[model samples]
Target: MKVTRTRLTEDEKKAWRQFCQASHASESEMLKMMIRKVSGSVSHTSARNAEPKSEKVTVRLAPGDFKKMDGRAQEEGYLSRTSWTTAVVLAALYREPVLTNEEVNALRQSCRELGAIGRNLNQVARALNIEFREGDRIKREAIEDLAERIEEHRALVFELLNKNMNRWRQ
Candidate 1:
């Protein structure tokens, strides 16, 4: 084995020793023991990290409702209720997310293109004597259609975004 110098805090050193003794048997059994122990505990430790990430949280559901949701989350493979809900809440909070300067400009360009498309679609709708529904209008089935369109455009968007992601030197 190639030896490399590294530093560990006292607590880390003690934890390592205890973890080795309780689970790993000895340092020679890397693949057979330590891997499994670390894999098991890492998830729980990560699950606990979800708490400090949230600010204002409310559990407004009736007594059993939250439990049901937690059960559903667990069934869907999350570690814990706090972890799952924190993720949902954070995602909701950052739904639109932030963009860099270039991204803001790119979004402006995309808006222009989309506006042009919307205008053309509106003209088509008018010619066909059909009501024009805004493409962004929310509908139950529209999510699926929007997802399909997104999948279709993903490669093109990724390429375009990657190319435009850089700074435009003034």
Candidate 2:
């Protein structure tokens, strides 16, 4: 890191020392005030989106459901049925545990709904005679989202880093 140093006059030095002392206490008070201000804003925007996934599987569908799920997975975009099912469950299920039970159930229902969606979607894909591996579908979706965010942030960060690199070189 590059930092600049400067000499201060006697009057300025005394003021600077007082400012430093006051800022130390002021920083704490400022932080407390900001925390209070932001505590309300700490919304469940993305964090409280869904509930944490739990194993307690007191409910498992029949083998026929698996078969249907497999077919649906094939239609959606998966190669291996088992892996596809696991991915489906994981993707639609997991979230922060601190959320409410209603929120958790909502997420769970979404998982069930996704399975039904896959079934219906696969039927459509089948009618269209399209064969997409579930793995590829999931991967393609992930890469697309990642590429978008990376491209966005990289553009903003590149100039800052480039300037620092040049300063060091000089």
Best by TM-score: 1
**Candidate 1 local lDDT, 36-125, one digit each (tens):** 486764422332243575466677888798887877556534444654565455445655322333344455556666566556555554
RMSD of each: 19.2, 27.2
Measured with C-alpha atoms, the lDDT of residue 147 in candidate 1 is: 52
Q: For this target, which candidate reaches the highest lDDT against the unseen true structure?
A: 1
On residues 66-160, what C-alpha lDDT tens digit does candidate 2 reach at each position?
78776765654443454344544444455212212223334445556556655655555564455454656755565565556555555544544
TM-score of each: 0.27, 0.20
Number of clashes found in candidate 2: 5
TM-score of 2: 0.20
Q: Count the backbone clashes (under 3 Å) in each candidate.
A: 0, 5
